[model samples]
Target: MTTDHRTHARVAVVTGGSRGIGRAVCERLAQNGLAVVVNYARDAAAAKETVATITAAGGRAVSVQADVADENAVTALFDRAEQEFGGVDVVVNAAGRLALSPIADLDLEVLDAVLRTNLRGTFVVAQRAARRLRAGGSFVAFSTSVVATRFPAYGAYVASKGAIESITLILARELRGRDITVNTVAPGPTATDLFLDGKGPEQIEQLAKAPPLERLGTPQDIARVVAFLTSSEGHWINGQILRANGGMV
Candidate 1:
């Protein structure tokens, strides 16, 4: 474990921090002077690279491996943060899985996997964070604009995200008076491997045009929103689902 002795600095645990939007969030939060615990389900190399980027920039971070869906693993992930950095002040549940298929054609197995990772995983992580995060902490969960778009072939993915939004609001209320804000980030067509995979140029172009900004959102764009919601200025904005997409809905 990489330890940062800055006792007053805020500590953040970002799941799926090894790649894509999760990686961007880890970097952004670290830049904001937070001691970050970068969590990854697998891909140790990618997780290491994320930590390297943060440390290279004079930020403190450590990469931990855990399956978000597993309660025990999630607990250990949080424990590592408290042990190494003092206490957790921010948690970004960016760990998720996506499966595309129209409801009629969706495989039960794929839907099960998506639900397990996106929905159940969010619950498991949120449960732990709710219990352990110090006062003034914040929890950010990821959702999708497709929930409103009702895009075909996205039933399973959207269903999982929808549940995330629901739980986010409820969790925020449950934490009332804790000074810990809980919110969900719903991003529209973002430029990441997760969004680009299985998408052709035409489909990608169409999505890019859907947003008023006329382009796919970058990982950094989404990261900025997460940063704000975790910051002191964003403390008052709790139990909200922020749509980071460029006016797509």
Candidate 2:
């Protein structure tokens, strides 16, 4: 899946590139002629596999370990990206965790995890990208479509992503004079492990039928959009929450 005649080869850092949407982003960016650094928090083997995929396909990439929520680790991750790939050109904050619990039974620990990983983690990564990215670069943040649909057990998770959407506005303003753009991608319920875990057959059927597009989104679907948002063609698209949720909700 090599891209055609990429004018400028840039360096991109994709957090949580070990699996799901993150892996898809890494593969797409690598194919688009960027030397990507695939950052993973815990899945070392999966991270390496993404790297291998890129390398095997004749693209340049590396697997780096970092918890995007941890400031120190994130700083180190950015530093390493600069050291290894020259400088960071794009940053995609795709790493996230989802916990389902009703508000009454919502574990405080689960709430903390959700906030730390999705909101705070995205902030840390986006801030670094804003400060470190070169002119003409871009920063993309991930938010879930659940924020729009507002399912029952997804309250906390949606809240965290909602916070991401809020922060994206601020970050875009902060990138003012620089040619860099900041935006959020709100994906509809996709068929990722994080999304379809406990759904029974009936629930799955209902969900698949609910969306106007009549199917769950694939990683490749979201990945292609992320690639576009980070590309030169997306320069004018800033401070917008682009929803890629198959017209759902």
Prediction-by-prediction clash tally:
0, 0
Query: What digit string (tens of lDDT, one per residue) describes model 1 on residues 1-249?
Result: 333334477999999999999999999999888989999998999999999999999999999999999999999999999999999999999998988887998889999999999999999999999999888889999999999999989999999999998887799999988889999999999999999999999999999999888999999999999988998878899999998999988
TM-scores of the models, in the given order? Answer: 0.97, 0.96
- RMSD per prediction, one decimal? 2.8, 1.5
Model 1 CA lDDT for position 233:
78
Candidate 1 all-Cα RMSD:
2.8
Backbone clash total for model 1 is 0
Query: 26-132, model 2: which lDDT tens digit per residue?
Result: 99999888999999999899999999999999999989999998989999999999888889989999999999999999999989999999988998998788789
Distance from true location, Cα of 119 in model 1, Å:
0.3
- lDDT for each candidate structure: 0.93, 0.90
Which candidate number would show the highest lDDT if scored against the true structure? Answer: 1
